[model samples]
Target: MNPPNDPRTAADDDAALRALYGRAQAQISAGTTARLHRARHAATTGSTASPARRSWAWPAAAGFAALFALAIGMQSLAPPAPPTATPAPVLAEADGAAALDDGVADALATYEESPDFYLWLAANESTLLAME
Candidate 1:
């Protein structure tokens, strides 16, 4: 006698359930494939963004060279001015003042010996005194 609830009948009606399960599995696999593709793309882009080991030295050297050149250019463009030195003292002859005094004495003697010197001096003496 056939069983009251045979598994075969349930399985015969299970086509719809099987189709649903297959669709869910397919969606999960598609999502996983898309995620894997995105992960691979991200890895590739990350590697490209990083500097290569072989070419690493060039960037560092270029940076140092640029800094060195800038330092040299600034130093050459605005060099420090030279320090100023104190000026030397001027020297005068020891007899210079004595010579000037003798010349003045001779002029006074000559002016006194002139005949009209007193009359001229008297006329201008008040003006000369006023100046004094």
Candidate 2:
């Protein structure tokens, strides 16, 4: 007969299952029990990692990391294309260099001396700056 549902809480249900499992286990043969015992032992004692796996994992990971670092460092070795155009070294602070600097002073002097020139410079200021 089937068990009653009422008055049987989880502990009662667990006792019933244990009794059923005991009866089922009592009926099994000796050879089947030994095979089951061996299978259980082998499974519980199994090593998930083998020696061959340990041999290569760290070395392979390290080699790939080194190669990646090498690729990153090689980026700076090309010397940046020599800047394509070198700016001529200015011979600043010399007598001749002072004359080259006086062009702006000379223009400013002309503007200050002539009122018409000052108006012309004010009008052309944007164009003059853009050309420079």
Alpha-carbon TM-score of each model against the true structure: 0.25, 0.32
Where in model 2 is the C-alpha error above 4 Å? 4-39, 82-132
Whole-model alpha-carbon lDDT for candidate 1: 0.82
Clashing pairs in 1: none
Q: At residue 8, give the lDDT of candidate 1.
A: 89
The positional error of residue 76 in candidate 1, measured at the CA in angstroms, is 1.0
Candidate 1 per-residue C-alpha lDDT over 69-93 given as tens digits, one digit per residue, 9 for 90 to 100? 9999999999699999977654454
Error of 1 at 126 (Å): 98
Give the per-residue lDDT digits (tens) of candidate 2, residues 22-131: 99999999999998887787779894334576888899999999999998899867567655686766676476778877987998787779988767878899888989
